[model samples]
Target: MTELREAAPSAGTDLLDERTRELADYCAAMTGRLRVIGQRLDRDPDAITEFLHEPQVRFPVQGMLPPQYRSAGEFPAPLVAASSTVLGQVVATEQVAYGDPNVILASPGPSLSGGVVQALADEQQRQRYFGRLAAAPTHTFFALTEPAKGSAALELETTLTPAPGGGWLLNGAKCYIGNGARAQLGVVFCRRAPGPWGIEAVLLDTSAPGFSGELLPTVGLRGARISRLRFQDVAVAPEDLLGADRSPSRRGLYGATYILYRFRPGIAAMALGCAQAACDYLRTHRATLPRQDRHRLDGVLDRIAAVRHRTYAVAAAVDAGVVDVAGIGAVKARAARVAEDATRLVAELLGPASLIEHPWLEKTYRDVRAFELMEGTTNLHTMAAFQSLLRSRTALQPAAQRAVDGAARH
Candidate 1:
């Protein structure tokens, strides 16, 4: 309880958190072993399940779930200290990611789906969903992206029809969903009728009739079991529709959007961690390189520092209940770009042969690229940032043109 007293002036967060610093430090120490398993998991994605309960793998996953659901000892004391805030999640997520993004991704406990539950699930739904998680170490996924819809997820083609007798039927396909094939339970988005307000989300079981999912041969982040799903009139109960107890306006898309706003920073933190990993890899192996090459690596470190500080600031803002949509979008987009940039620069400076020689750095390159496509792409975020700026009147507009004698008409 002492760890939760208040933010201290000078221990961790001079950069981290005065109290949460210990958790961040502990996570950093654990990455070495997590990294080993991460690489092995990349080689064989199935290997993850066997190691799910190991402390390095389980601690971070447990940390993400509500403390009420997880066992007492899984979280470090520092983690318990910071578990109450979005910033604490950010700190824990970033540091654990520094070990291996796959380690956390493969060990499931709600994840993106949990965010939706937090935002819109009724009390019963909350217990039912999270209770399933509390029962054991389980895998859960969020299914929204589709083959045709891409990032425009709100324009859903999937449909949820009322059953002849009662309950409902879910029919749609979602692709590029993480942990889709292997997850025991999940959340699916679909349209109950026409128009924007018609769309809704529901809890689903992969074993339900008419549901099928298979892994996609993804080039990166292979451990996530990125997969394609087809739903052929899958059964869904009226109770399964999340937020059904709430008004139409508060259900469906609102919760999905809520998910994006709430989880974007943590996603960004993953990219930030991978960037740090790439940069650290560059620094260690650059000793044999020419002096000029080593200096370029230093510049990348500076950029990482700048990005880290801002990521923390944005995460803290979320904790303060500020959802600056544009800012959050830009943070995710920028962090991903920075990660790709770091990996690319390191690959170049270390020489082409270096990727072959250093497997960890090479793996980092692939994983960072996957980070770009996570949640949304860089292009989507930039447009979102611009739109936010325009809405706020912060974006610069073109100067008004006046017809003059010298002006020529096209």
Candidate 2:
């Protein structure tokens, strides 16, 4: 038993090592793509998409995440790192990499590569698809929340009806969809037939007929390239029915849940990154500012570090599989809270400069604000974590009963 326990960690470590290497490879690929994109920053979207189709930039759609951990304990550190790196590169080049905003969105369906096929125990296919998606800048979106339905999955009004030829027809409008305006492909969750259990995942080709996108003007995160998407009887091939054909199998649900779970850590990472950016900006500008604000700036920095540490710790725990979904949700909520607080603190410390367009603090502030809304909103996650803890407490009763029964037997 002791040996088994000890070996478990080794196994996990090995898995982590393998994933790290894959991520490193992805990072290298992304670096090459960004170099190419750099030259075409001023080019139109069609040119950019064409540039992405290059062999060096194209990656397979599979192997993006460990299947078991994809929705549960996987940190998706590679994807998050790639995103941060890409964001930094785009910002540095004075261009927005809005090719696929859905890559950052936490919906579970296909990997970031916009592959139409779903994971169904096909390791080779998964790896191939993951590699392809990771290598290129494919804009993807989570078209779940609608203006009418909000975050209520059961209230989703988007419909996916079966066509005569095994294909599906999608009709709905997605609002405030990240990457919607520029995404080539997206994973859209729609009510196949509205009822108690009607939600199904479907992959949509954004460039297909009857699909259109309009940019939404927003006060914050203006550069995020958010837009509203309209699908009017959009024709989808049979291959795009990602997990929608099943009779709601447990495995399918688990796969979906796993994807949602993985996003918690990613959302937390985004928050941490935004908070760090804010704090870094404050630090860089402290010396140039008035002496009176130095002490306040220092305090903000300390708070930011503390918040960042907690976020990293939670992220590490999720990656290590030490935390379950509820724990991850709690951690995500906490990370967002800390990020929000830290951003506000830094903004306060920076005063007028924090709001200026020249400084990244403003961008950080806006981006961090979005983190609070992403994955699961802080309030919703808190409620979910509390409910999960309650369920766990109830589940402990049986274990306690077994212990008592064993004692009596003795």
- TM-scores for all candidates: the values are 0.90, 0.65
Candidate 1 C-alpha lDDT tens digits along 1-410? 00111221121265555566766766666777788888998999889978876888877766566667777765655566575466777677777777788887887788889988878888888899899898877788899899999857668999999889898888889999989999998999899988878889899988898999999997778888899999998989887899987887788888888877878888888888888777767666654767777677777767777767777777788877788787788888888888999999988987869789878888888988987888888888899888887766643332223334236553
lDDT of 2 by residue, 1-410 (tens): 00001011111122234443344344333433443342343222234445434433332222333344232323354543433321221121111111122122322224332322343323444444444444455566667678787656667788889877778889988787766887766677777765645667766667799999998765454434568888898887766656544466422233445456554565565565455445555665553756666666566556545544444455455455665667677766876776777778777776665567434454445556766776678788878888998998999999999999999999
Clashing pairs in 1: 13-16, 13-17
- List ranges where model 1 is wrong by over 4 Å: 1-12, 288-291, 394-410
Error of 2 at 268 (Å): 1.0
Q: Top model by TM-score, which number?
A: 1
lDDT of candidates 1 onward, in order: 0.79, 0.52
Residue 227, candidate 2: how far off, in angstroms? 2.2
Mark the regions of model 2 whose C-alpha exceeds 4 Å error after superposition. 1-137, 164-166, 194-197, 244-247, 250-255, 287-323, 352-354, 397-410
Report the alpha-carbon TM-score of model 2 versus the true structure: 0.65
Minimum summed lDDT over a 10-residue window in model 2 is located at 1-10
